[model samples]
Target: MKDMVELSRRELIKIITILNLGTTLEWYDFIIASTAAAIVWPQVFFPSSNPASALLLSFTVFALGFVARPVGSILFGHFGDKLGRKTSLIWTLLTMALGSLGVGLTPSYIQIGILAPILLTIFRLLQGLGIGGEWGGAATMATEFVSNKRYRGFWVSWIQQGLQFGVILANIVFYALLGLMPRLEFFEFGWRIAFYVAFVIAVIAAIIRYKIAETPLFTKLSSEGQVLRVPFIEMMRRDWKRVLIMTGIFLQASAGFYIAISFSEAYIAKFLGFSDSFAVQTVILGAIATIFGTMLASFLSDLIGSRRKIMIISPVGVILFSIPFFLLLNSKDPVLVTLAVIGYYFIELFGWSVMPTFYAEWMPTQYRYTATAFAINLATPLSGGLAPIIMASILQTFRGNYLIAWPYLALVSIAYGIISAISVALARSDTAAKKIE
Candidate 1:
């Protein structure tokens, strides 16, 4: 308890690198399913619906994971705080492994009837629960373990970029499998293989995570018995506004971003008539954009102390670019689609890359994981879980008219982003923030 040890740059990088790799693998599982749903689930689970409606149903089941995320945050954050950071993260990865293998092995609706979608939903919920807790634990570890100590935002931002890294990996592997398989074979078996592959990735993530010790900050807190009795309750009672700000940021960032990334492949393939390979490739490019844009935005946030500033700009870009984005996709030309996805990549960067820092910065040392987990998770059910279903519903009713759907999406993004900007402008810390008034 009396030790005053200093962490070296090498040691800090070592910890951050492992955490980032594990976080990327976690996202790899999530994106694999989203991409799989866009490819296979509509036929497997909801064969009775029209293609559009079936896709909608598929994403709805997919959203089940997002729905389960906050519950995971509450439960895991409690134990992570009360027990230890390392322990919570290790188990979260294992939970994801079970869910992934479950999805990979589940019988289709044709075989199991209604039980198929039900079991699929349960697996996705478990997946979401694991991810829900994983984000804050990983971010706190990255931010608090660093040696430079000045650019917590940048380092945390780098960890944030791991989501895109996972997306890129998922996209590449899925795209390659699709390329190798015939269309019929691909739809029948390729998708399931991707889900199964997560078992291996999860094992790798666990191995890396196990080698890394607990965050020094958490170690310090443990010795002092500083863990919260009830982190979510304390944050809700004490720093409710940050929760609101995070909710708003996620509402803006997640819904629109999901529409752009998660929904884009099927949207383009079905509505715009692109080939499967092109659609998958478009997602890959956008992921690449996200990988780079995330780090760039995080670097800027570190310099500016304006995490909200980055999020606020993304929606504005969406509103201004929505028409062009739609137009770019509609042409079905690869170059134009790439251009559209590139625009989306930057949009995701602007909104998402800053979120880790923004949410983490909103709370102080005492309740960082708790506040960050709760605040950031509001996006799951509202924004993350619902975006694909909402977008599918919008297109189903409007029949894929951007005139109707994009404006509505843009409006939602605008309201959320503006409010987020206001909150960021007002919030200097939990105690001094004017937006709480």
Candidate 2:
């Protein structure tokens, strides 16, 4: 395999662009469902339930995708590690496109009765499986292409930025649709247009991915015959503790992000008495902040010379601002709500921006694909997948007092901060142990 130093600037740029496009498509499709779950899916699929119950049910089905993500991680991780990154990524993209197409064409309960939600759930599961594998592959491909180790964080952050861009794009489309169409028409057909658009983007991304070569690190490992026959099993037996640490590290960021982006829209519209358009606009502002925050955090990580310190400190800030975040939202002003969301995401960027580079460096190149996918997918169900439902339940239990949800959010952030601190200590001890040996 060629070293990163051997690759030309053009080749590096090409690789990053291709991989970022794939992640952007994946997140675009996923965010469509998330946006719909909060704004439209309940009306279409769960009309029989009360508004809160219907939204909860929609989010529950949304979580089903996260439930299937670990399986996807293992399935694609196997081929990604043994076969190749490009090959596995192509397949993941195709799978996600299929799910997006299915979702776009699915009829509402009013049209097809109970079968509507069943199909929606099935397609959501397919999407979960695809995205479960997409992140690890994209992150690996981007970071491994970097010639200078110092800039790995900056390069890999493009993948995270792709996700934020998808959120921005999704909200822009929704915002435009809401502005153009009447409420009934927007609810009935406008949302499905976003899914169709996502499917088309996914296909284009898959074609781009297919043309790219495998990463140099994976090629090097494969050529050396260092690849494991059963990478997942090996990861489980040899590096399970690392997997646990990764899961812990991601929990709060994942949950906090979904709550801030997905659940906040519904909370604002339904609980806070804001318009749906205002809620969508708020997310767009937040996503814009997230993109800037990711780039800034990545640049700072390189300058600071420690990803772990940034990750640990970011969550502490989130904990400190949790109450204030809710208070800003409670102001019920669109501008304040937008500012609150942007502030929250800026803090979130600290951990998230460094994750791709951190995970790539933490795992062995031989089974990095499988291990990273498995750990992240496992954490998703616990955090991002359940975030909406958890928040909804909290709102319901507390009788729509948005402020009451702050403690839960704060507790999660504190736990993430503690876990990150412990992980850093464990990593230092492991390094010392290796030196002693």
Candidate 3:
């Protein structure tokens, strides 16, 4: 598994930096929007007589971003495979920049009536489109740049690690704002600052990406005239099963991760009556723990020489913890709630570090970006995008019965984890040390 082009230490470092920055910006923008939906947008853009209705509408808009992701994936994934990763990445970053900037500048409902929500939805969709293709390009670039097949999971994982940093960074910003301003002020104007920060991150990431070269594997494909005209169609015709399996393998994380980080914030602060600062603080702690957990898992995946084994085993943790996680959250005890949040985020996603490398290795050079992005994005809207709305609906449906509601919620997560485990186990392949197909 020799590298097509060997990178010097400095060049490799720069490549990794740009990849991580692009992904970090992607998730940072996503997290801030989630946070805003939970605490800000319902009040600002979707004002209503009934608070719950307003919150649900805001969550719907947030989910719209996830809905637009697959479309983004298809659009940019096409260019990524046919043209170059660098070009696709630059556009994705700028698209996200425009989205975040629009969100930051858009007027509130009081100022602009229905147009506020309409503009907000448009911006959110743009954010989704940008992120839909961002992870695939970043992950593919990282995979192609490095040569050592043995620890490729560990290296590409740095791009995924941006998710943890994004969570931490977003929560920290929100925590600081909540601490400094009154709750009323935060709802009024403080939330806009977070989206502005996202705009800045996109600008920086786009500049770095524009300066970098395309991945060596893609360059080689281009030079040899092997690039596919329609990578998505080619992938579906030949590797559809693999795509489906990969989508299933991602379901556990797709559902549980968003439930814990994005939905739980609203659940904790709005429903459970925790303070905004407390909710943000808990997320920051959980995100910090996840950084270490995922890094350890990456190291283990490489050490074991089987990403599939790690993938198959990790979902069991999610299945086992699903019930307990909700039980802990329902306790209304700060200590228990904090522990539950941390464990929910950490345990279910222990195998996440292997995803980028695993997905990339399964596809041929020409189809890698389109296949990987399509698979992940398909799973995203199915579970990750709708998770908050679903979880909230369950809670509202069984309004007075905490016991029944919590377990019902847990059942949904358990189902996803079980599906993920079975999917990975069914995919009988060992590509850990093999060259990319």
Candidate 4:
């Protein structure tokens, strides 16, 4: 138990990497749907007289996944707290895997009629449930495994980076598949295979997750008879502010991400009329930058001792760059298009790369799962789910111009960034770690 409190660097990296990988896999499954929807979902699952309405129908079903997230948090959070991080994670990954696979295998609207969309919505709900528990468990695993008080800023951020990795993997696979096949073929058959691939990722992620020992932090807590009887109630009574603050912080990150990925997918593939592979390649290049950007943000946070700074400044920088990036996107040359995608990727990672460190630090060891899950799950899916749809609607109804939508994303990023900065400062100044309680 004493040793559990002070983990070694080797053990810390091992646990952190596993935590990162699991979430990476989960996010890959999660993110692929958004990309698929932007390109394929409308044509396959939803039928409408107009392209705008069809896209809306697709995004509406996408949003359905978000609405069910809180329910997943409640159900899985209960099991994660009462059971253990290890056991709960295995279940969570498998759930997401199955759901993702179902989506990939689903018969299109042409064949299934209403059943296609109905089945699609059901699978997305399953994904929301799996992800609901994934972040809290992953965050707790990384933070709790650390030895030195200071290392939390560095390694905990790795968990967040895992998300970037998942996104990277998803983008690479999607575009690579698109590239290998013709656009006509991709829209026809290739998209379904992407969903099928999740089954493989899930099996591997589950095996890796199962091989790891239960986190020492949670095991010690449980062995000492300190496990909460009701983790959600404990979170509400003890540290609701952390939930609220982290939620705000997550809003910036999630919105930035969805704009870069979700909305951006539609922007590039649907709007720009780029080849499906080219669109995926654009996203993949950005993912390449994120791998570096996210780790760099985390590493810098360790040196600076302030994650709030990274969260606030990087997003604003992204907002400033939005115009230039959009202009490059318009150039339409593959080289310039790739650069624009990469640039946006860097902007989006700014918020995501740093938030895990800050968010994971917000809770005490006892209630980390509940607090982190509630903040992040709600923040992400709501923002991630809505941003693309709203952007689509605006483009359809008001702005005939696509790049004009940058202001909308930029404004949301700034608002969330301001709120996050204020909250972190308040938390840092408080002397009692238990102030939230």
The model with the greatest lDDT is: 3
Order the numbered candidates by TM-score, best leading: 3, 2, 1, 4
Please list all clashing residue pairs in model 3, or write none if there are none: none
Clashes of each: 0, 0, 0, 0
Q: Candidate 2 residues 1-437, lDDT tens each?
A: 56777888787878888888888888888988898999899899999446778888989999999999999999999999999999999999999999999999999999999999999999999999999899987887776677255566887899888889888888888899999999999888988999999888898888878988887778888888888999998998998998888887787778777877788888788778989999988888888877877888888887767777667666677767777887788888878888988888778656788887777777887788888888889988988887677777776677666567657755654565565556545554221001100
lDDT of each: 0.74, 0.82, 0.85, 0.74
Per-residue error for 392 in candidate 4, Å, reads 0.7
- Candidate 1 has what TM-score? 0.92
Error of 3 at 46 (Å): 2.5
Model 1 Cα shift for residue 162 (angstroms): 0.9
Q: Candidate 1 lDDT, tens digit per residue, 354-374?
A: 677656655655677776776
Give the TM-scores of the predictions, in the order they appear. 0.92, 0.94, 0.96, 0.90
- What lDDT is reached at residue 39 by model 4? 75
lDDT of 4: 0.74
Which candidate leads the pack in TM-score? Answer: 3
Better structure of 1 and 3 per TM-score = 3
Model 2 deviation from native, Cα RMSD in Å: 2.8
Least well predicted 10-residue stretch by lDDT in candidate 1: 428-437
